[model samples]
Target: MSTLRPGRRFRTALRLAGIAAAFAAPPLAAGAVHFSRIAPLTGYAPAPAFDAPDIDVPFDPGKRTAVVVMSNTGTELTDFLAPYEVLAATGAFNVLAVAPEARITPLGAGLDIVPHLSFAGYDARIGADPDVLVVPFINDWRGAANRPVVAWIKAHAGPGTTLLTICGGAVTLAETGLLDGRRATTYWDFFAWVPRAYPAVQWVQGQRFVDDGNIVSSAGIANGIPATLHVVEKILGKAVALETARKVGYAPVAQLADPRFTLGMSPLPAVLLANAFRFDKTEMGVVLHDGVGEIDLAAVLDTYPRSGTTLTRLVADTRRVVRSRHGLFLVPRWDFASAPRLDRVVVPGARGALDDAPLAAWARDRHGVGVTYLRGDLGAPLAADRFPFDLTLADLARGESAAVARWSARGLEYTPEDPAVLAGAGWPIGIVVWPMALGLLGVALGTLGVRAVRTRA
Candidate 1:
C-alpha cells in the first residue's frame, strides 16, 4: 500500500490546516488537532477548476494523545465528527482523519472530509504507534472483503495504543477478528444483526458502551460521546474530561446506558446543543447541489443536529463539489452513484428546482422527502407544486394551522420531527404530531390542536 501524495485531498487538508494555524490559540500541554471553518477557496472563479496557493504551516504538536479517525466514502458524519470534536476540545490529543488513500472522502451530511494521512504514511508522518485508534462503522460497512481498515486495525491494536469503535464501528472492528472472544456492544438497532454477523463476539445491548480490556466499544451515535469521554478520562484525567464535558454543555456518563430510555425535554435554545437520543434511527440524506440556494440549512436543521438522527449529504456531480449561493463551499460526502441508504432526503430549492428531473425523481422515489425554499416570492406555483416538498421549514419550526391542514388534506404520510421517524429534541415537550387518520378527523372537526414539549425536568 502507498501513502498519501501531495494530491488534492492532501494539499487541501494541509492548506486548511495552514489557515487554522494563523488564528490566536492557546498552546496545549501536548499535540492537538485544531479545527476551523476552512477559508473559501482562493481565486475561485465561476469555473469549476481552481489552483491552491503554496503555503508553509504545520499542525500544533504539544498534545499528549495522537488520535487517528478513520473514514472512507460513507462513514457516519456524527460518528466521526462527534468524537473528533470531543477529543480535540480537551486539548489533549492530536486528532486526524486517516484513510487508505488521500482523496476526497465523502461522509454523511453532504460534506467531504480530507484525510490528513494515508495508513501507509502514518509511521512516517504521525508515528508508528498512536495513543488511540477511533473507528466508526460507515454506511458501506459490508461487502468489502478484508479491507485495508481491517488490515490496519490488525497491525495496530496492542499495548500503548487503545483501540475503540463507536456505534456500528464495532462491526468493522469485529471483521478484523480482534473481538472474536471479547465482549462488545453496538448500535441497539443492529443488536440482532451484529451477533449473527459476528458470532464469535459476545454482543450485548442496553449498554451505552462496553469495555473489554484494551478495546472500548460504544452503543450508537451520541452514545460514543460518553464512551470517548471515558477514554479521555483514562488518558488525560478526570478534571480534563469533566472540563471538556462542562465546556461543551454535556454531562458525562460513567457507565453504559441506553439513550432511548433517557430522553429529557429541553429548552428551545438548548435544542441545538442536544443529540437525538434514539438508538434505532435510520440515516437520512440532505442533498447538496452546484450554486445551491439557501434554505437556512442550519436554521432548518436545528431539530436534527445534536441528536441521534444521522443526516448525511448526498451529491451527484463529477466535479464532486457543492457550493451554496451565499458562498459557503460544501463538499459532498456521497455522490449519487455511491450514495447509501437514506430513509429520508431533504432538498433545499434552487432556481432550477422545477427543471432538475433527477432531483425530483430521486426524491419522489425515496420515502419521506423534505423540501424547503429560502428564496421568498417564489410565487404560489413553486410553493404549491408537489415536487416532493410537503411543507416549509416554517411549518416545521412553527406549525401553522392552515399549512398543517393543507398537508393533512393531501394525506402526505411524512411529518417533520415525527417521533416515529426521529425523536429529535427539536420537537418541544407535550407536542403531538397528528397522524394522517387524526388529521382527517381534524379537517372534519374544523378544530386544531398543538402540543410540543418544553422545559427540562
Candidate 2:
C-alpha cells in the first residue's frame, strides 16, 4: 500500500474540519446555552414617593450636578449615552461623564469615549457628592478591575445622591451591596443570572423601571430613555420631562412594560453565528463632530456593528477628540485627510445642522463613498419612536437587509411593533446553507480523490 502525500493529507483534514465547523458554528455562538425551566416573572411596580435629600457637600448652586459613571474597561454604548444625553437636554443639571481613569473608555459593540473627569478629578473639581449618579453596565462588574469603580460608587452613595442603574448595571451596583433588599429591575435576559448571582436584592420585571426611593433601576438598553425621563420628572417636574420627551420624539413614559420581553430559543443565535462567519464585511465610517447628539451617535455606533456584517470607524476632520452635545468626550478613529477607503459613511444626528459639505465632498471625491444621514436634520427626530435603536434598525433595513435588521433587533432584546420594518425580507439562508453545501461538496470531492489514489496504489 502507498501512503498518502503530506499535501493530500493536509487538504483532506482541512476539508473535514470545514465540514465540522459548518455544523459547530451556531452552538459555539450560542455559548453554553441553557433554557429557563419556567417563564420569567413579570409585573409593574410604581415609583414610590420619596423626598430627595439636599446635597451635603458644596456644589454649583446654579445647576444640580449629575455624574454618569464610566468603566475604562468596557461600558455599554446606549446605557452610558441615553441617560447622559436625556439628562443634559433637560438643562436642569450640569451633567458629567466620569470614569475610573482619564483614559479612553471603550464602549461595547464599538467606539471609544474619553471621560470628562477621573474619579479623583471629579473629587477635586466638584468636591461633593453628585445629586444624581448614573451607572451604565460595566463589562467587568464582578472582576477585580471593577473594584475601584465599585469602591467609587460606594463612596459616592451619599444620602443626597439618587443612584440610577441601567440594564445589567444593576449587577454592578449590586456588587457594592447598596442594592441589597431593594426592589430593582435589570435587562430581561439577566432574569436567570442576576437573581442567582445576587439574591439579596428583590428583582422586579414587567416594569420599565422600579424607583425604590434613592436607588432606581431600569430594564435593558432603550428602556434607559424612559427611566431617565422618569428621573427628570421626579426632579425637574412633569412639564420639563414632557418637553424633553417631545424633543427626543419618545412617547410618555409608561409604567408597565410590554411583558413579552422574556427569552427563549431564538434564531438570533444562529443568525449571529452565520454573520460572524461571513468573510465579506462592509467597512463603514461614522462621522464624529462637536455637539453631536449622544443618543444619535450611540444609535449609529452601537447598532450597525451588531449586524456582524459591518465594522464601524469614527471619522472626523481632525483626530482630536470632540465633545458630544452633553459633554462626553469621544475620540475619532480616523481623520478625513488620512482615512482609509471606506464603503460608506454615516452622519449621526446633531444638536444643529452640521455642515457636512466638506466631509461629503471628501468621501465622494476621494473614495466614492456616499453619506447617509441618520436623522434628516436636527429638526426631525431620528425615528417615530425617537429611539436610537429604532433609527439603526430602519437604516439597516433600508441599507442592508430587513432580515438582518430583525435579526439584529432579536439579538438586542427588542421587538418592533411595526411589521413593515421587517416586511418583504426573509432570512439570508445563503449565509448558512451555501457554506454547509460547499463544505459537504468539498468533503465528497476529498473522499473521491482519496479513493482514486487508493485504487491506483
Candidate 3:
C-alpha cells in the first residue's frame, strides 16, 4: 500500500466521478426531468434520474468506533476529544482511545488522557470489523517522512471500516494510498504540499470535508467534529447529530470560510455590488469571512469546565498554532470588515455603521443592497418576504428557524428527532463541491496550456 502516482490520481478521480454520477441520477430515459424543471438550453443533454426515492440506513447502536489518539501534543487532542465526547454521548457506539501503547498519553497542554488500548495491544478482538477509525493530525504534517500509521491502516482498515482523518492525518492517509486517487482535504496549510508531496490525492482546498464513500477527510483540527457529526447524521439521522451538537453546545459553522472576513473592510454594500455581477451557477460557494475564535466557540460548548489552563491555550495559542500551521484562515470566527478582498458583499445587518455615509456611498457606487439581518445567537431568520442567497454561519444553525426552512435553497427537511440531518442541511451541496473541485478541469488545463505556450513563444 504505497502512495499513488500522478497518473493513478487522474484515473482514480475519474472513477470517483463515475460513482458521483451514479449517485446523482436514477435509471430512466437519458433526457427525463422528474424533480425540477429543465430548459435544456444546451443541445447536448444528459439527465438521468437526479432525485431518487430517499434511502434510509438502519441504525445499530451496539456498533463500536475506534479512535486513534496522538501522544505527541495537544493540538489534535481537542479535535479528537470534542468529537469523542459528542459521539460517546450518543451511546450509539463504544469509542476506544488508542495510542502507540497503553500508557498515559499527554494531550493538549498538561492534560494527559490514558489510552484504553495500545496500537500493539489492539487485537481484532475488539470485533471482526471496525465501524469507523478516527486519526488525529498533530505534528508537523508535511515533514512526516516515515508513516507507520499508514502501514497500520493498510493492515487494519477494511472496506466496511471507515478510515477517517483530520488535518495532518490526511498526510498519513496519502502514504497509505487510501486517499491517493480520491478527492480529500486537510488543514489549509497543507494545501500547497498535497500536490507536491502526494499528487495522487485529489485535493479540494476550500471544502470542510470530503466523503469519498468509506473515506472521510475533514478540513483540520476542530473541523473533524463536524465531519464526524456528519457521519452520525448520515448513519443515525440528522436530528441525532443536531441533538449531539446541542448537547455539546456546538453550533456548526456550516460554510467553508466565513464570508465576513473575505469581504474585507469594504462597505457591505460595495461587496454585495461586486457579488451581484458575478456569474450564477448550479451551486454557489458560501464563505464566512470572519470565522469564530477558539474561546468564543469553546464558550458556546463550555457547560461544566474545569481548568482554565486548557481553555487558555485553546483560545490564545491555538489561534497562533492554527495561523502558523495553516494561516489566518484557521480563526474560528473573523471580522468581515477586515477581509483582504471583496468582489461583492452581502450585508446582513443594515442598522450598523456599514450604513453610514462612506459605506453608503460605496454601496451606492457598487449597487449593493441590504438583504436581511442575521442574528448570531438564534440563527438566520427566514423572511418569507425576502431570502438572500448568501447565508451566514449563524443563519444556518437555527434548527427550526422558518426563514431558514422556507428560504433554504433546498429547504431543511430533517427534524430535530432525525439523526441523519446534514450539518445545517448544507453538506450535500458541500460534498458536491468537493473542495478545490476539478469540475472545470478542462478549462484549467487549457488555461495552463495557453500560459505554457505563451511563455515558450
What does candidate 1's lDDT look like per residue over 339-435, in tens digits?
7666656554544544456665765565445443433321223343321122332333242223222222121112222222122124433122212
Alpha-carbon deviation at 214 in model 3, angstroms: 0.9
TM-score ranking of the models: 2, 1, 3
Q: TM-scores of the models, in the given order?
A: 0.51, 0.81, 0.44
Scored by lDDT, model 1 comes in at 0.52
**Native-structure RMSD, model 1:** 23.5
- lDDT, candidates in the order shown: 0.52, 0.72, 0.43
Residue 366 in candidate 3 has what lDDT? Answer: 41
Write the residue-wise lDDT of candidate 2 on 1-457 in tens digits.
Answer: 6498989999989877866765555434332231110101000111112222221233356999999998877788889988998898988898888888776667754467767788998998887899999999887688887899999999998999999999889999999999999999998779888889999999998777888999888888777888888888888888898889877766534432333245334556445544544445577788888888888887776666766667776778977767777666777757888777888887786324477678778889988976777676321334533555666777676655676776667655555545554443455565666556555665666667768999999
**Candidate 3 local distance difference test against the native:** 0.43
- Please list all clashing residue pairs in model 2, or write none if there are none: none
- How does residue 114 of candidate 1 score in lDDT? 50
Q: What is the lDDT of residue 267 in candidate 2?
A: 52
| Model 2 poorest 10 in a row by lDDT | 36-45
Point out where model 1 deviates above 4 Å.
Answer: 1-62, 252-457
